[model samples]
Target: MTSTQRTSFPRQGVRETAIAVKTRFQSASDVLSDCLEEIARCEDKIHAFNLVLDNQARQRASEIDDLIARGIDPGPLAGVPVALKDNICTREIATTCSSKMLERWIPPYNATVVAKLQDAGAVIVGKTNMDEFAMGSSTENSAFGPTRNPCNLDYVPGGSSGGSAASVAAGFVCCALGSDTGGSIRQPASLCGVVGVKPTYGRVSRYGLIAFASSLDQIGPLCVNVGDAALICEVIGGYDPRDSTSIDEPFSGLLDSCDKGVDGIRVGVVTELLAPASPDVQAAFTKCTDKLAAIGAKVDEISIPELSYGLAAYYLIAPAEASSNLARYDGVRYGLRVAGQDVESMMRATRSAGFGPEVKRRIMLGTYALSSGYYDAYYGQAQRVRTLITKAFGRAYESFDVLLSPTSPTVAFGFGAKQDPLDMYNSDIATIASNLAGHPAMSVPFGLGANNLPVGVQVMAPTLGEAVMFQVGAQIEGLAQ
Candidate 1:
């Protein structure tokens, strides 16, 4: 039997492969073949993808080879194999958010980012799993089942973007797209030992994304390293007329910005962010911060008191938006619908059968929060708190070029270790503040912590500050290595 373990695969990532493909050092077909083989070897064990489009990937590779045969450059991400989170639609593909409701639902068009990736010659392997409607922190909530961490099969690969991060760490794909509503991307990236980013709101178009929280959701990349993350970000990010939230910002040359170094940069270590983290994580965080100082960065502990309420605010705000956005799935149109005596009954039956426990829980919580007489007490207060968090982030950035903290409170935990929902919510405590603030934040793998599982240090920058954020990340990555 072929070994199911994924010990190693091609070290050359998105950047190296693009260079090799262009120079004839490696044909796109040959490179894709190697990637496919690795995916075959690992997917069964890791459960990284909701679907593996082997034939489609192979066909795309041939097309890229044809372009190279005619001496044409297929843009920056040439021939790179990428995995997209299932929530990000691809034309004619099942854009299920790992929910049974849309299990057979296919999208008529690709998301703006998907189109961008295809245009740049990226070979999309398949759609990775995600939480139902982008809710939940662990992949466990997926109606399709959980994505096991490649680092420890018994543990979850942090979630709702668990499969996206797992695919990169397991070598199933070089990069993957995932949306962050809270710490969906960064927390999972930390657990799975990869670079995961939540770009500033509006930085990446959400036209193709199935919404969970319109105000908080932002699509970003999970990659093997900081430079790969930067490359993927530049490719999929830009202004899009289709998405009302798409900002008119030039996203050129993010890779060039990565090497700017951290010398003389100011980094504020948020004290409150660290207080919730486990001791093992705190130690790893200190080492990473030390590396920044050694490289001439000015590091200091800063307090953002308002940030303490961020997770509470996010739980209210995100679910409220989710309840509203998800209302479209009321069995009146597309997705799974069960027959009933009348339309209302059919709709109620379909939703009851379609949604998982976590999703239903949030919908109820959100509906209650948005209901009359309770809005101000819950959802309204949450929005006010969100504003304070945003201002708090701004206040920190005033004295610092970037803020730093442990991406998660602990390393990947065993399935069911966090049985209580409250316990699971703490997993994202360190990373949620930025999402609530609509600022860009990323999780950079620093080193191993408990059980030798990876620990990631989060670097959050001001709005439109991804360039400098990546620059510091590249530096931290160098030290960790």
Candidate 2:
């Protein structure tokens, strides 16, 4: 394993870096070189990157510099180096998803978000590591190896977007794109002490994201702060014709509304979240609410009874979808294939050999749930629970502008602390509800806890209320500073 215990890298700002490049205050080439230099310094210790497209990054930077010399505006994210979670397609770039199944497979097209980022002038730095096909909470399930926390190398970075969060926290890049299914993005961002956002289902196009659970999967941004997150959200969010599930609404004024504090905003503290969080995490959350209250926000406790059933439903529903989605990865189409007597035998051999243990476990669980005899008892019932969860959120939103909770029950834990699947499942307890309800939620770094690891305070909004979420998140960030 690489030595991940180095001192935390000073984070870079997405907006500031873009501004610097746009104004010629710093050349794009110089900025990218600095990023590469920083990556070189910590890449060994962090192992955050799965593939570093150094030459491509340099060439892109040079092109941006030339555009600037001609007095032409590139885009909002101009010249900013951004990391992408490996599951996202990147044209010919390798997007392994940190799994051996796709280790040798390269996509022929860019994911919608990748195209948007490139169109907006953000330089694609490289593809960061991730949990295999966005499975597992710790990222330890990755076939390539685990991504360690930058805060303390002994600990694991939260995942499956661990490397994306680690890259930002390690200062390898200003911002990175991560797809959230359950707590994939927020949990890791909380552990890494950065901003992580999961837009409402359909708020961002999921056309190119390799599906973990089609209903729960939403791609969002992990960045240094709320401002950066809001900026990226605005840039990538909107309707996409290719995505049938996409909402036609555009995410307007995110950057403008993002800095607004929670003054007079009605923030609800989820009643159930208190029990699952550690005392230290509870203390951090209390302090954050107190700070918001002191700043004139009205904070109150609200009950979302259905939230208690979230985890149980999520495991069943997500896996059921995952089993269906993963069915396409059989030996016939692409990725890894092991020799066998014939087609059926070959498909069986490939999947058995290619999928990691965690993935296989889920596949089996999902397949069993979707089986004729158990479908209604498991999968059907789980969807009903999801509807109830969504209704609970809707009721809460009637009285509260945004909801708050600890992003995770505790902070970044040691690698082997939660080996059992049940133990690992606890990590996403605070985040699964929002995914179930298809609501926008974010994890904002609140402060350091007694363990010295970062504690994140989650802010959730109603289906298209990202503006409200970011505004409240900004207030939480203010408390931390």
Candidate 3:
């Protein structure tokens, strides 16, 4: 059927329909096809999708149609189109993490997050690109190439979840899943002008996601709006027996809190974040704070002195964990293999040849940090700093219901502008502390910046305090509108 004709068909959630036959007015196939067509139209410019599951998506749509015809409910997200970060496993799709090492590997099983989305009747539209092993701040580090910012092609979409953010920003999908180890999700969402949430660590199971830093990694929703993010989180979150770190606590009323409003809420503006941000970002944040005050929220400045050390500490700790977690991909066990005379040589050659420059840089830094001579100087010191930062957050949370900061220090930059590795790493400075503290944080589009690109205001709450985060985020979202 023609794209125009298919789009004209009546639509229902994938799970809502039970018949396989396409109706005169509407069908699941129609909705899926239209979305696919939209993706085709813009994906070239955005470079968001790594692999488009055209056939598989069509088949799922047909199945949903049959189910609806049978009068069976497909469930909340049934047939809804959702894109997944390439780092997240999908049965036969290549979950590359935008790295050469796993370029040809297909996961044998779906990740926990992917499974939940599937159960909800969501169609996997495609795998989105990301920084190799989720190690960099810009999508330019991806083996596949960078994902362009939808708002301005010359600028970035943010990373390591850059592709996922761009896909949603470009309207390629209603929502997408991105893994955030240290600001990956929130940074990109902010850059792309979309809603992105980084759930408290352990809130979402990390079973099949390619590990960056196991302790800090989280899978969350990137969507067009806060409500969409909340909806997707409801479907993918909750305890998982398979993930030991997964909290056993019942699902928190995250969605319900969205409508609760932020009246009488205590919002803390971190003074450290304000000083370093560009004037535009600072102004945007100030305007947001004013809006909160107008809405009856008590806005106050709170200090987290230790947060200034977050970026340095996170770089050390995350890479240390990542070096260990990624060690398993040696030539013999799995992934790309390099033939050599001995086992050691084979493993060395494979890794050296497969991993991207950014990944290698991190692995080397991590190895050096964890190495015998420097362990105390690097990794140990970073851990101690982390403890201090965490404590500072704890103290701040005690005084304030939520903490607010500009999601990024600056607006999106040109793809390769931050060529210096250290410069790129610093891009995550403002958003990394929440990851260290394992708190729920979200990025909401607050206003336009110097380049006319979107600027985001990040709202963070104490551990497992997503309900409060949502309330504050919803308030900010309302103000932005």
Candidate 2, residue 72: how far the Cα is off, in Å: 0.8
Q: Give the clash count for model 1.
A: 0
**Candidate 3, position 157, lDDT:** 86
Q: In lDDT terms, how accurate is model 1?
A: 0.89
Residue-wise lDDT of candidate 1 within 1-481, one digit each (tens)? 3343336432467888889888879888888888788888777778889999989988998999899999899888888889999999999988999999999899999999999999999999999988788777779888888888887787788999999988888887888999998989999999988999999899899999999999888999999889999988888888999999889989867899888988899999999999889999999999999878988999999999998898898889988988898889888879999888998999999999999988898999999999999999999999999888888788788899999999999999988888898898888788888878788999999999988889999999999999889999999999998
lDDT of 2 by residue, 332-364 (tens): 878999999999999999999899999999999
Top candidate on lDDT is: 2
Better of 2 and 3 by lDDT: 2
- What are the lDDT scores of the predictions, listed in order? 0.89, 0.91, 0.85
Model 3 scores worst on lDDT over the 10 consecutive residues at: 4-13
Q: After TM-score superposition, what is the CA distance of residue 416 in candidate 1 from its true location, in Å?
A: 1.2
Ranking by lDDT: 2, 1, 3
Off by over 4 Å in 1: 1-11
Q: Which candidate is the best by TM-score?
A: 2
Instruction: Give the clashing residue pairs of candidate 2, or none.
Output: none
For candidate 3, write residues 381-465 as lDDT tens digits. 9999989998989889888999999999998888679988888888888889989988889999998998888899999999888
